[model samples]
Each structure stands twice: as C-alpha cells, then as structure tokens.
Target chain A: MDVKAEIIAILKDVTGLDDVGSDPAENLFADGVLDSMATVEVLVAMQDKFGIQVPVSEFDRNQWNTVNKMVDRVGELEEA
Target chain B: MHNITPYSSPTYFIYLLLLLSPIMIGLYNGKRFRVYETFATVIILITAFFGGNMSQGISLICYILFEMVLVLSYLRYRTKENSKNNFWVFFWSVILAIIPLVFVKIDPLLNNATISLFAFMGISYLTFKSVEMIMEIRDGAIKEVKPWEFIRFLLFFPTITSGPIDRFRRFQKDVLKVPSREEYVALLKTGTNRLMLGLLYKFIIGYIFGTLLLPKVSVLALSYQHQAPLGLSWWVLAYMYVYSMYLFFDFAGYSLFAVAISNFLGVKTPMNFNKPFKSHNIKDFWNRWHMTLSFWFRDFIYMRLMFFMMKKKLVKNRVTMANLGYLTLFLIMGFWHGETWFYIVYGLFHAGAMITNDAWLRFKKRHKKSIPSNKFTECFAIFLTFNVVCFSFLIFSGFLNTLWFS
Candidate 1:
C-alpha cells in the first residue's frame, strides 16, 4: 500500500473503527474517533512503520487531525 | 517610585494605556516601535517591581538570567550539527528550569511561612515558558533562541504575572510583525470589549460575589458547621458555589485584562477561560477552565508522559495508563498550586473524577442504545459537572482545613 493507505490502515487498526479514514478531512479528535490514548497508539505505530520521530511538542493537533493531514505530515517528515 | 501590580486597579490601567498609546499608534500606522515598546515595558516592569516589590524584582531578574543561560545553552547544544541530543542534558535543563519554582512552592512547608527567597510574582508562569522552550528545543522544533526574543516572550508585561501562557512560536509570529491597520482596528475593538467585560467581571460581579458574599457565607458556614454532618451544611454549600463563582470571575477577569493589553500591543495572546461552568463533564471542564495552564500541562506533562509510557510499553492497559497519566498530572498540579493537604486532595479528587468519568463514558458507549440521550440529559450532565467542579473548588479553597484543623 501507498504511504497514505498505510497511514489510514494504521489509524483504523489503532482506533478500532473500520470507517476512520472514510473522510480524508474528518477531525479524528473532535469527532471522537481518536482519544488521547488512540492518538498515542497511532503515533507509535507510525514511528515503528515509517521510522519518523514525531515529538509530542511538535505534534500540532490541528495539523494532524485528519487522515490527509497525517499522510502529508508523514511525507514532510520523511523528506526532512 | 510608586508600586503598581499589573491589572490591579484603575490607576494601573490608566498608566498602562498611557504607556501603550504610542505603541498602539505605531501599530495603527503599520509599524512596530520596537525600541519604544521596550522602553514602555521597562517602565511598566520598574513600576510593577521596583518600589514596594523591590525584592521580587531582584529575584525575577536573577531567575530570568538563570533561565536565559540554561535555555540558550540547551538551544546551542540542540542546534549543533549532528548533536546527540543527550537525554541527561535535556533532563537536567528541565530540572534546573523548575528548581526556583520548586523552592518557592516548598518554602512554605519548610518555614511555616508563605514567603520564600525564590518566591516572586509570576515565577510559576515564567518557569512554564522557560521549560516549554527547552522541551521544544530538544524536539528540534525550535531552531533558534534569540536572546532578545526570549526575554521579550518571558517578560511580555501584560501576561507576565499570570499567563494565558502563549507559546514561543505563536508569540514570535505576532511580535515579529506589525499588523495591518484593519487587523489592528479589529484587535482594538476586541481589546476594548474585553477591557469592559473585565471591569464587569472583576470590579462589579467579582466584587459582589467575592468581597460581599463570600465572607458572609464563610462565617455562616463556620457557624453552622456544628449542626451538620462532617461540617457540611447548606451554608457550606452556599459558600462553595459563591467561592467557585468568585474564583472564576476574579481570575477570568484578570486574564481578560492581560489578553486585552496584549492585543493592544499587537500580540494575540491566547485566552484562558471559555465559560467553564457550561462544561458537561470533568474533562470538558478542564478544557474550558484555566485553559492555557491546562493546555500547558496537557502538552508538556500529560501528553509527553503518556506518549513515553505507551511507546515504551511501560503500562500494558490503555485505561490504566490514562488513569496513571491523570493521577500524575493532577498530583503534580496539586503540588504546584502549593504544599497543602487540601491542594493535594483537590488534585486526587479531580483524578478520581476523571477516571470515573472515563469509566462512565465507556459504559455509556457500550450501552448506547439503552442509555437515554436528550436535552434533559445534556442539561443534567452540565448541572452535575458544575456541582462536581464546585465541590473540587471547595476542597481547593482550604476552608475545610480551616474548619477542622484551625
């Protein structure tokens, strides 16, 4: 799978919601799809899978609140 | 050489406005008078600290110097090419950053007196900013730490004493640029509105509730303590609600003044309150109340600790991990408030509330179909949350300690 698809898969697995990635711009936090614990789990999974370190300080909720945003952030991190 | 506490009185506001007029004019014409702004800030600081508060002024200066060295050194280490980002260095930097605050917090316990050599107004809030910078630097999020910008961010006179705890990046963004005339006009409108609201909240409503009602209710609560179980009476309940309102209005009022003056200075300081009593749950209450401090705690302490634990697989169960996180966060918060039994109990009480709230949420989710959901339920949830929060404030107020111990 592509990076985007991989991230969406991770989100689904972490949140236990099959339709988590249905909307690319859905707010995972506001919609209650991802709580603090699930968000941490997703971050951990991403680090393990993609080898990108996202420090808690650098994690802006608004910037990473959606599947599309998460994929884009991951891409940016990969490039850096 | 007159002493003036920031946002303390009408006279202070008048003096502040007079000082800010030139800055406001500069911003209106799409310019930042950096030198004049610094001059005005120095004058304000001198008035705030140099007169009756001379000792605090000295302490603040020493503390700032200590933090600047620590932070700049850390930033240098972090920014070096191929730096290892040593954990011990970062760890020690944070510890050193918080040591003054620790001394101030613990001095009361050691001496049975509130005063401490390290104690100064806004020490806790200043420590928050310094520690935040260090953390972000370690994360490689902060690439540069200019000395002037660092000091200005820490000593931004309006919110220096008690912050809405503006982030370094956010504050830098506004401080580095002068807003357009239209933006400045909008900011001025909002600032004026906030100033008026602050007057109402602090002088009028807060005065009525806190100065007028609180003392009378306190006396009543104490007098009626013998007639009720565990010294809990209608009067005590009255005192709790009154005290809660007083706390909210007074602090929120002060926060408003801070934010308003920040806007006038062309910086968009984050707000601290958001109608907290309207919250439907304990977690929601935290998000709405003392928002900046809570967000700071959430970002720096709670989130970081939780992430570390989950990453290391330190705690196997997610629920247990969250509970532990809440416990640590609130306990530290309690201790941060002061070294008092009531403060500690207040922290533990909130932790328990949060854990129980989590359990109820999970159970409700499981039984979503059976659990009735409607307008009444929502209102009931808000009412229940309000009472729970008021009770927490009662614990925080230390009136119980006075009743039982004193």
Candidate 2:
C-alpha cells in the first residue's frame, strides 16, 4: 500500500469520521482532524501498519503536525 | 455550647492569604514583573502544608513534579521541534500517572476498599491535570514557566478542591492576565453565588433528598408488606433519578464555585456542567455530567485503548459480536472509577446503555423521519436515559461486593 494512503486510512478509522476535510499541511489536532487522544491512536495505528515504533516525542505540535508531516515521519522511520 | 457552622474554617486565614497571593503573582505576570512563573507555585505549595492530609501532600508534590517534568521538557524542545522527546514524554507520562493509580488506588480498592487517610484531596483532578500537562508540553504549546508560575498553575486553591478541569493553555493565558477591581469583585459575587447554590444542592438537595426521599423509597422497595408494589419499583427508581441529579448538582455546583472563586482571584476556570438533567441520551449525559471527569477518561483511557484494540483487530467483530471492543472500553472505565466490582459493573452498564441508546438513535433518525418531532418523544427519551443512569448508580453503590456478576 502507498504509505500516504495507509496513513490516511488510519486517520479515517481513528477519527471515525468518514470525510475529514483539512489540508494535508493543516495540523490534524488543532484543525480537529484528530483530537488529543485520537492523535495518539493514529500514531499507534500507523506504527502497527508499517511495523514502525514512532516514539511519543514524535508527537510535537509542529513539524509532524499535519498529515504530510506525519507521512514524512513514517518515511523517516521506515527508511531508518 | 459554642456553635460551629459552614462559615467556620480552621485554616481560613491562611487559605485567604494563599488565595490572595496568587493575585499578586497574576498581577506580576501581567506587569511583566516576574522572570519565572513556577516560583508562585512553590510559595502556594508551602501554604498547602496547612492542608488536612498526607494524601493531599503527596498529591501536591506529584502534581508539581509531573508539571515540572513536562514544562522543562517542553522548554527544552520548544524551538528545535523534533518529536522524539514528545514521544518519550507522552509514553513516560502515561506510565507515570497510571502506575500510581494502579498501585495506590485500584489495588487497595480491590483488596480492602479503604478510603485512605490521604484519599488525596484532589487526586482525580491532579491526575487529569498532570497527564494533560505532559501532552501539552510535548506539543510545545506551553511557552514559558517559572516555579511561581507552576504554584499558581497547580495550587490556585479554589479549583484545587473541586475542578472545572481547566485546560492548561487556556488556563495559562487567563492566569497571566490581571483582573480589575470590578472584575475581581464580580468574580467574588459569582463565586458566592455558586457556593451558595452548591450548599443548597449539597445540604438541601443531595442531603435532604437522600435522607427524606431516597432512603424511604429504598426501604419501601426492600420491605414489601404483602407484595412488592409494581409502582413502588418506579418510585424507588424515580427518587434514585432525582438523587443522582442532586449528586451532580452538588458536585458540579462545587466545581462552579471553585471556578468562580478562581475567577474572582483572577484565574480562569472552565464551566463544568451544561444542564446535565437536560441530556437526552447516555453519551450526552456523560458529556454533560461531571464533564471534565468524563472527558479525562475519554482522552486518557477510551481513545487510546480503542486504538490499540483496532490495531490488533480486537475490535474487528465488535459491532457484530458485541463481545470485545466496547466491553474493554467499559472495563477500563470501570477500573478507572475504582477496583470494585460495582465500579466495573457501573462502567459496563453505562457502556451497554450508551451503545443501546446510540443504536436506537440511528434507527430513529433513519426510520422515524415521517413521524413529527414532539416534545413528548424528546422528553420520553430523556426520562428513560435518566432512569438508566440512576439505575447504574445503584450498581455503583454496591460496586465493591456485586460488581462481577451478582
């Protein structure tokens, strides 16, 4: 599966919202795509899918803040 | 006999100062007079020595440590903005909060159910605040802190006893601002109003209703003269509903008082209740009643556990089987309430009620569109859901003994 697609699917499931309309660059938490705990849920779900252990430190408010940033994080971890 | 009443406070003078000093700190923060905010917290904590119990002392210490850990880490990583520290903080903070709860709270409740000498004045609030702070810190949302800032943050005594569960970022901004005399006086009146209303709820509503109406209803139910009256069950059940509302009013009223008191002293406290009796359904009720406490459970327990279950495919058959996913969520809720069977049952009962309510709503929305919306239908559902919640409280009352299966 494409990593971005996988990420998007996980976000969808975690939120239980079928259509989240935020831009990929918009912060998931602040933009309300994911709430505080849902953010953790999505992070954990991403890790399970890709078999990567994203640390809690990766939950920074910015940088890995949006979908695209979170995708980049997955890429960094998978490559590592 | 020398008379004593609610107006009397053994620690009134010190608490007054403890409450007042925060104003100066808020004043200083507003004046840009202080370099660090945590110092105010330390001074207030020094004042907290006059508090009633050891549990309170431990809670005070732990809250500050957890706050410091998060604040220091946030300050360290705020600029560089990598998430490794954020990850560690969240991971560690969750563990830090849960370990104490498991060992100190749950274990004892299961074993002896002793309400410890320390029953910790504000354990519930502190746990929520500490965990939320760690998450906020990891997000780099908190910009600055000094020791005094932390004291003001944690030990602002009004919200210390009962809480509106103020969010840190929102609370921090409010703490930094100074209230004018008018605003301050208005806050005092508001606090007084809440406090007075709370007394009415607690003494008049929760207390009098508990004694006069609730127990009488219970006794009648238990001691059937010839046969258990069919209507007697409804009476006991109805009064239970009223008592439960009174209980929330009592607690939420106290929370509002604390919020108002904090506001009067120039601190912002969030609104805790939204007319819970008006909640039409279980989810809505939880969202309305003891709201901060419920939200704490949602953010800390439910969402994380649900995510984990979904990841493992444990919840895959959940809707179909009604077996695992939501049950686990409820069990967590139960355990979060305490270690007794009552709490567990209470948790599961709520889960079952809420799921049923949700399914029913979806069915109604889908099928009953043709039926005109009526106050009767709306009020009937609210009536039913209220009865369900009150019935669940009965399970909690016996939580320690009969929670498992009885």
Q: Which candidate tops lDDT?
A: 1
Residues B265-329, candidate 2: write the lDDT tens digits. 56667678878778777877876787777766665456556555656666455343233435666
lDDT (0-100) at residue B223 of candidate 2?
Answer: 52
Interface RMSD of 1: 1.2
Cα displacement (Å) at residue B272, model 2: 1.6
lDDT of each: 0.91, 0.61
lDDT of 1 at B71: 97
What tens digits encode model 1's per-residue C-alpha lDDT throughout B1-406? 6567788877778878988999999999999998999999899888878878388789988988999999999999999899999989999999989988998987867757654656678899999999999999999899997888899999999998889899999999999898999999999999999999998999889999999999999999999989998888899889999999999999999999999999999899999999999998998889899999999998899888888898688999989999999999999999999999999999999999999998998788667789999999999999999999999999999999988888
Tell me the DockQ of each model, to 2 decimals.
0.74, 0.13
Model 1, residue B370: distance off in Å is 2.0
The chain B TM-scores of all candidates, as shown, are 0.98, 0.75
lDDT of 2 at A5: 76
